[model samples]
Target: MIGPQPVAVASAPLARRNPVAKLAAALLFSVVLIATLDPVAPAIAIAVELAVLPLFGVRYRVLARRAWPLLVSAVGIVVTLVLFAAERSGRVLVEAGPVAVTSGVLLTALGLVLRMIAVALPGVIVFATTDATDLADALIQNARAPARFAIGALAAFRLVPLLGQEWQAISMARRARGVDAGRNPVAKLRLFVSTAFALLVGAIRRGTRLAVAMDARGFDAGVPRTTARRQRFTAADALLVAGAVALGGAALTASILLGTFRPLIG
Candidate 1:
């Protein structure tokens, strides 16, 4: 049973909401924010998201851990824009040789980074708080998604944590066989690639076996499948989606009032 463990916060009000509702809320919030291309709106959206983390029983430390990748991406975006952006309309902040960092370029980069985090964080929160089984069940029951697709996706998701363990095991086995890369960077990269390839092959084999096992268990037998736990869409769930829409709209409205709202479509 070495699989992905669900976030242990059963008493969290928002975390206990229907999976379909959370999914819808995240999607709707992202969609509304996507209509604007300014830093202001996304900044507001991010503020709201952080403000509501406690309601979801997600601590600041947990969110920081989960969002480190986004922070890395933001740094990359800022650096790339500062170095290579062509639209340098505003005042120059820094100039060195062929590289010029202007306020316009910096603003655009900040907007992109903020928008990326704002748009992606909700999905991260949903997946972190919601169990795979509950998500699949909600998809099948509330969203009316195909059982085959939902169950298949759930099964695949449950195996994701194993990939990390499998990679480490493969690396250790290779090291035990005297396949250490030592101090050479090139050798390290080659070793990494070879280990990844081995992991991929093992994953494919495991997936095939899992598919066959599921088939044997009548998963795809075209008969009605009963759920062990039922997911219900409640009034609170509806309010959650509505609240997301309102929050996004308010952010955009603020941006518009501040004259920072840039439409995504020209």
Candidate 2:
């Protein structure tokens, strides 16, 4: 007979810290960055975030890998803004038919790019460090989220990696059967769409099955559910929340004092 099982514990500080605390920190930082889209504010915030990432076990390379998509999108925005943003009375840098690049426009676009990076990177770091189960638990326990909804979200998060593996398996099977088209962009696009459709169908099937299983398990039986691991808010969590508030406030105050407080919409 199975007697007593030892409790599993997190060794790392990031892993041990409550997910609600991390979520609060990310939201606070994002709000500050979104309110003032000035380059100086984001620049300072970015520096602080960069230094803070190591506390969450995030390396520079890992951060870059996770944020490359945002970086690429930011670059695209810069290019589009430089080409099409309404020209203001400033020194014109480039004048080509229907496109005018000015110093003021470039600066504006740069500020947007910097702000995007500063706001998104912290969230990415938090997500990368936190486990999906821990996050769902924290949300349910600390944030007072509905248990059913939180569990459903946790199930969806679990399916993501499974879906990736399914896609890779399908691709490999196609290659084995010699139907995989390589090097042709049009064929690749079609293949990607077909794979995506397969994944969608699989996801729907899995979700339906999961819902039915939950119902069968009496999850909808109007009885309060008990958690396997009780989520607790520690002193560390309180400190994290306080630190988030202080950081966001400091960033905003510094931006205003430095005269770079440019509200995104005003």
Candidate 3:
């Protein structure tokens, strides 16, 4: 007999942890990595983050789906840096009009690529599993963020997935109605822009309605609002933050010991 299909739970232990912890971890590591232009520190951070992701229930396929765009961007960045990086002290490998590729430039490009990868991957892994509601709750409860700002931000974040879903439905409905935007590149582009504009207009209308509803419900009425589900940090949340700190510290210490640390602006 076929049993019921299992529903995927988006809330893993990592997801259960307070959203503020995740944000702080990502922000702190980004700051540390961004302080140095050296490749070694960021590379270490990326490797450590990848190693720890599975413990947080981030699967290979999930990571790949979210990472593909970043990978493409990283490649573009590498090409741009190689062509335009001003560091020319090392041996010139290739020369073109107004653009010279030197060993120094290539090295700097490598560092930049690694740094971006390090900074981007953790944020994707963290935010992909986090719920907008949980984030707003955490921000308001733990970070002392204004309730109005947190609630408004949460509403905006929640709309993104709905926007994608609505786009797909609109596209399908258009196709079924014989409003065919053929596969020609320009035609497809026009269709995309039209659909995007429609989506934007719809989103604005919905947002205005939501704001009115909230106003009616006395949201941000200059009084404290009570949440049905209070945000609370658990031991797991502490561990996650500690792990992030340790990872960044270890990377920086190793880079310093290896004499590969180079400040970004100093």
Candidate 4:
């Protein structure tokens, strides 16, 4: 019975909003931020996101854990930009042989990293706080999405977590069969690749079976389907989407006022 579980906070107002609202808000917020290239707007957006975490019932520590990958990417961006960026217009901050780090390059990297995090964080929060089933239901009910598409997406998303467990199980089964990489890095890499391949094959087989089962259940019948659970798009949900737009607009406005608003197209 290992499956996707809802992470929505029962007592949190935002978390209890319709899943489509959360998703639309996240999308709108991200789309607005994508129009800017400066760090200032993203910085402000990040601040706004953090400030509203409690309202969403998402703790800072939980968000950090969920967002560690973005932090790692930020580090990679800084290193890559420092070593290879051509726009070294500002004063040199560090010079080591062929490696030069300029203020301009660093600022560009920071902006990119910040923008990435700011744009991505809302989606992360939405997914983290919302249930897959609820999202699918909301999409079908509130957003007027096709049932086939929403339900299919929900099925696919539910299968994602099983991949990790299956990988572990495959690795253990292999090890039990006297397959070990030992100390050699090359052998370890080969083992990893082989394991991944095996997992992929298993996943494909499982997916094929699941698709057949769904088809047999008349999922593609094109007939109207009835829902056991109804998802309502309330006034609060509308307010959530509006808040996202306002917050994003405020961030961009702050950047423009500060004269650091770099348009993405220009």
Candidate 5:
């Protein structure tokens, strides 16, 4: 099942490559972007991140649909920070007891919100194009990471969508069975909590079944994997990682030159 609707970008050959490489690149680039709070670095990172939506066959509209909340929350964070951050020595914009806004504080708040957006935007980009199963295989096989953990993670990933559908189905079934799950405010809240608990129980049962199945197959932590599909880092993989590095480097350079690297405190 599709998580969200796939975007309309011309599907690139990038997804065929090893997912570990792309994941590594994403993690590395995000770490680099987050290591500093300089607005210049994150701003540049944001631009690069914008390019990802299209490149990953993700439509702009799809991104907007999903990312609008993050954008809103980022704005909310800035507003809250600006209001609540302790008054500082800089030229005051507004002054209230214990809560002060200054030009410097406003700049800092803007930088903070921008940085949060920049840091979070990339995972949405990469995961949009990336296949979860493929990524897990790459982690286990190509990276020689622990197979058990990778497999468990992959199981959880698959379960997310399945469980959601199951929850919806269960809710409909419950309603059809005269559960009195009317749309009244109190009833809706009760339905939500009850449905959530039911879903949890169902999930636990499914997890038990999955564990039994895995055990029957000798899917132990130390077991050597049997080859099914081969996973390797291709040339595209190198390009992805290299491109992330270049983008990160550019961000760092801009931050230093623009003197936007403001650390939180010594």
Candidate 6:
């Protein structure tokens, strides 16, 4: 789920540039996109990020695999807002118990879903392109983030693929054990939850063993470590930083000039 295969990024001629540079550029651009609530800012960010996705050899098909979850989340948010928080409905569409679906509430919630996709799409692009190990290094070394926190985040990310595999294996094993088929949706959910809890227990045990093994191997606590692959900042780094800053400045100026700089939270 994270970090590029070192072999993959390393082999690409474009990957020779510093990892921290890419991370900085992505983070700065993302921050600018997030800073302004205006949909235009995120739309611009999505365009820029999508343009850069090819440079990293990202597959949209593979990216869609991750994007669906985000899309589902956006949909869930809209439904929840419509059900519970749509207190002011200019036009009522449905009435169930205390819940009323109104035209205005539906429109506002739909706008939020659109906003979520605009915001999330660019982040998905950046994450797909970024190498997790490089990200850890960029945060821990270049950005001077707390090494423990960075390392912990990096470590957690390592389990993405393993979890997926384990899920498949668990499903097969359950079937082999003569688990009933064609269960109701609730029953299927329960079965999955039970299997997932078992997987979590096994994963925790594995993590504990790994921690002990690393400690036994004389892994130092709170020590600054040297990188096997050092990322040296280059001219590209300067240009990217300047570009992100310019975009952020322009977005701010637009908001102020139009007198429509609404905070994203509201």
How many pairs of residues collide in each model?
A: 0, 0, 0, 0, 1, 1
For residues 67-173, write the lDDT of model 6, one tens digit per residue: 89877887898789887783665987888888888877776665566556655665565566557787787776677777666666677677667877888999899
TM-score of 4: 0.92
lDDT agreement with native, every candidate? 0.91, 0.80, 0.81, 0.90, 0.75, 0.66
Which residue pairs come into collision in candidate 3? none
> What are the RMSD figures for all models against the true structure?
1.8, 4.8, 4.9, 1.9, 4.0, 3.9
Give the TM-score (vs. native) of candidate 5: 0.78
Which wins on lDDT, candidate 3 or candidate 5?
3
- Who is ahead in lDDT, 1 or 5? 1
For model 2, residues 102-125, the per-residue Cα lDDT tens digits are 888888888888888888887787
Q: Which residue segments of model 2 deviate by more than 4 Å?
A: 1-15, 87-89, 170-198
Given candidate 3, what's the lDDT at residue 263?
85
After the best TM-score superposition of candidate 4, give how far the Cα of residue 250 lies from its true spot, in angstroms.
0.7
Candidate 3 segments whose C-alpha is farther than 4 A from its true place: 1-13, 95-99, 165-206
lDDT of 1 by residue, 195-223 (tens): 99999999999999999999899888888
Candidate 4 stretches greater than 4 Å from native: 177-190
Expressed as tens digits, the lDDT of each residue in 21-110 for candidate 4 is 999999999899999889999999999999998888988888888889999999999899888887788999889999888888988998
The whole-model C-alpha lDDT of candidate 1 against the native structure comes to 0.91
Q: For residue 58, give model 5's deviation from the true position in Å.
A: 2.0
Q: Compute each candidate's TM-score over C-alphas.
A: 0.93, 0.83, 0.79, 0.92, 0.78, 0.76
Candidate 3 C-alpha lDDT tens digits along 1-266 = 12111121455566557889988888877778888888999999988888867656777787888789888988998898876666577998888888888888888888888999898887887776676677888999989999999988877776667887889998999999987767788888999999999999999999999888878888859999877778887787777788788889889889999999898787
- Candidate 5, residue 42: Cα displacement in angstroms equals 0.5
- List clashing residue pairs in candidate 4: none
- Rate residue 61 of model 3 by lDDT: 81
lDDT of 3 at 162: 80
Error of 6 at 40 (Å): 3.9
**What stretches of model 6 exceed 4 Å from their correct place?**
1-17, 33-38, 89-99, 136-141, 144-155, 221-224, 248-260
